[model samples]
Target: MLRRNVRLRREYLYRKSLEGKERLLYEKKRKIRQALEEGKPIPTELRNEEKALRSEIDLEDDQTAVPKSSIDDEYANASERDPKILLSTSRNPSSRLTQFVKELKFVFPNAQRINRGGQVISEIVEACRSHEFTDIVMVHEHRGEPDGLIVCHLPFGPTAYFGLHNVVTRHDIKDKKAVGTMSEAYPHLILHNFSTKLGERTSNILKYLFPVPKPDSKRIITFANQSDYISFRHHVYEKPGGPKSIELKEVGPRFELRLYQIKLGTLDQTEVQNEWVIRPYMNTTKKQKILGA
Candidate 1:
């Protein structure tokens, strides 16, 4: 098993590394094909390889017309099965943090929360992998307040770290009447203002956490991006009078997440490269949005 895993990892890395070259070749073929269709001369930069590109284009079918991306490999089989998530807290979590994790368990369907007593990060990751969990979410607290969250995809990872702020748990909601009952139904997702490339990447990281919901599912979860901060909201809507008269109720435990770092490897790996990291001190324009256009 270990040998097979190492070989598979090597193959995956090799394919990922070749994406740039494959993309360049695809562009060359596209340019040559376009020039031929328009009866125009091929661009000077691609003239040398026009013959080869034209031949490849002729052999291309519908599936080969567009080059595949490495991102597709990361979650190629994601839709085939629902996500199984393992939720855990930092060691010796406070009561408040424990409550927050309990609330999170309901927030994500098919999630199981486990005690972090004496278990290290590596051990937790290994156990989740062995159990075929799709993702592992670890919440950290500062002074008894949940302040950080880590999401690591199983087997291989593109782990994302977010700083949690303004967390309001279900029990913390002052008005008990307004809080909607937590539903176990799969919730529909609404991803708003994730416009840029990085924003799209971040959105995918959050999107695959939930399985596909049915069309009739009234429960909705929204991840709205504003000024690079993602506001997480959960709600269940109803048609009290009719389709024309709709009512929406906010479920408790809303929070804001600011992405800080994305690592190419899982939580247990220390030497892997970081896909992206926020650099707050870098000199740039004051009004810049990393997660939105």
Candidate 2:
């Protein structure tokens, strides 16, 4: 039954890929057909382009078409699926994922470090079922620092990959009071002075982290910003003015996190098909190394 489910998912991915390719071809053909009806000269290059796209799609289909035997073998070869993860960096020496994973274990003891080697996304995500991993933190390499972060939750997820800089942990924080709050209080997310595109990516991350509660639930989620830094303060407060809302006097766990990294965007695909944002895209503004670096 597990194998059947995995097979279905792979089929869905292939169909989605094909759809993207088909949409591009359809747009091109529609433009060409419109030109013909209007008696405009269609460029020969476009004709060549259409042919090339068709050929490419056909080639991709042939190359990626999964066999039933391979599907079974994938599950069979899966080493182990457990919430205890095998964290490691890509083979790049500059990668900090290995180091990050080391530090992370203290905070999230569920993770286990594996030697850095060649591991792709398909195997990791697939292993989620076969190996039973609850999460995968894949950090990709960049020139100065390993800035790409791919956080995949299993058996399914809000799998997010994004570029971040100035990443640090609680140990790095001098003010222990910085650890904010995680109470019965609905989470409030804020984004400060993020560029338009970056803001969208951060917003997506916030949504994933603090999804909306059920309609009837009174879980409070707030969004308030203070210039450059995001502040999340959770407390139940009452409105004597109109409604009968009151503040929850009983406080909860405090969680204060400091993230200096400017969110670039969703970590995009790199040479490693499963790895995201190993290479940055152009046009968007990028951060320079911090003053000390």
Q: List candidate 1 segments past 4 Å from native.
A: 43-49, 178-181, 281-287
**Reference-based lDDT, residue 282, model 2:** 30
Q: What is the lDDT of residue 16 in candidate 2?
A: 42
Q: How well does candidate 2 score on lDDT at residue 44?
A: 73
Across 1-293, the per-residue lDDT of candidate 2 in tens digits comes to 47875686577456545765656665666666577679997667687676664555456454343323221222232324323444656665453445555554433334656654575656555655566565566656566455565555444343455454455543344455434442332333334444555344444444343333344433343423323233333333345565665544212211322233432111222322331232334323354311111
lDDT of 2: 0.44
Worst 10 residues of 2 by lDDT: 263-272
Residues 116-235 of candidate 1 have per-residue lDDT tens digits of 999999888877877899999999999999999999987788899999999998767776854656898999999999998889989988998999999999999999999888999888
TM-score of each: 0.91, 0.39
- For every model in order, what is the number of clashing pairs? 0, 21
| Candidate 1 positional error at 11, Å | 2.1
